[model samples]
Target: MSTQKKAIVFLADGAEEMEFTISVDVLRRAKINVTVVGVSLKNDYATCSRGVKIIPDVKLERNTFKAEDYDALIVPGGAGGAKTLAEHETIQKLVMEFYEKKKIIAFVCAGTLVAKAAGVPHKHKVTSYPAGVREQLVNVYNYSEDRVVVDENVITSRGPGTTFLFALTIVENLIDVETSNTLRKEMLTHENL
Candidate 1:
């Protein structure tokens, strides 16, 4: 309903610190109103994979919010983060609703499970972390085993090691490629975005 770039990220029990922070900060830098919504087991701060605690802007269990409040939902990857996200019925439902509307949804690293559980990619191109997890990612498993995958409104990136490029790709997804490239050029001297 509003034109503001309300981007909400789901921070479950163990999100990857880099994936969560990089995506949120870059989106904010690109002028999106980013909110870290914690999906905690007990309505508390989210504990990242790196052990850093993030106090959320909102708690999914305690709030009555619209999936439409945000234009996109970013799910960061971590062993526990992805597993926890994939198990949540509400989150999976919201993700499906967003995808059904053709809104943007992104998952980086092991978070790939959440996107899949939400049913975003039936057979489209997608990506995820390339370790033992690659074999388990949903759909197009053989396609993005090595690179960042962008299939229309659904974007996927490798992992925290690729956080910079991943965040920039998300910026490209929500805003425009030109803006993403410009920021990349500005951020990295030798970068050819």
Candidate 2:
């Protein structure tokens, strides 16, 4: 069987704009198929926390794509957005399905709580922006203050400030060091990386 890499990024009402855009950009640069899925009925338009309005490629409910069809699922962080995503039953089911299939599930900032809400917790290292949130996750997973943390199938990062690192790490995980390194230089993130 041929292996094809596809990814889905979930967008909520108040998602972190930078995290979402950076991830999609980096993943696409790595040649990974990326689908932006909105978690709201008004999926065509989502206003991020910082007042950036974004139009998702499609609504999650309307998308024909299934969990098994994608290699990874990425969730961006924004307190309101993460809470909305965590409370949604459909997103919860999707996350659980991905977890069961051993697919990559990534999150940034407050998005880590979505994983926790989905009942996917491991002792492996994980991280989020807020120190308090990190402290809370430490009880369930080995938490760190690092900018990016990848443990098994779970990948996480701090927040908007680390969006590049987070996206590059995702590329590294889904693609390869060579591809990620090349993109880093192209994106002028080589020094920071």
Highest-scoring model, TM-score = 2
Q: Give the least accurate 10-residue stretch of model 2, judged by summed lDDT.
A: 129-138
lDDT of 1 by residue, 1-193 (tens): 2365777889987889999988888888878888888886444788788899888888888786566667888889998989999989888898888787777888899988788777665676788887867777643443566557778778888898787787787777778888787778777822543
- lDDT at 46 for candidate 2? 91
User: How far in Å is the alpha carbon of 139 misplaced in model 2?
Assistant: 2.1
Residue 42 of model 1 has an lDDT of 49
lDDT of 2 by residue, 45-119 (tens): 899999899888888777666778999999999887898999988888888898789889999999998998888
Off by over 4 Å in 2: 1-4, 41-43
Pull out the clashing pairs in model 1: none
lDDT of 1: 0.80
Give the C-alpha miss distance for residue 57 in model 1, angstroms: 0.7
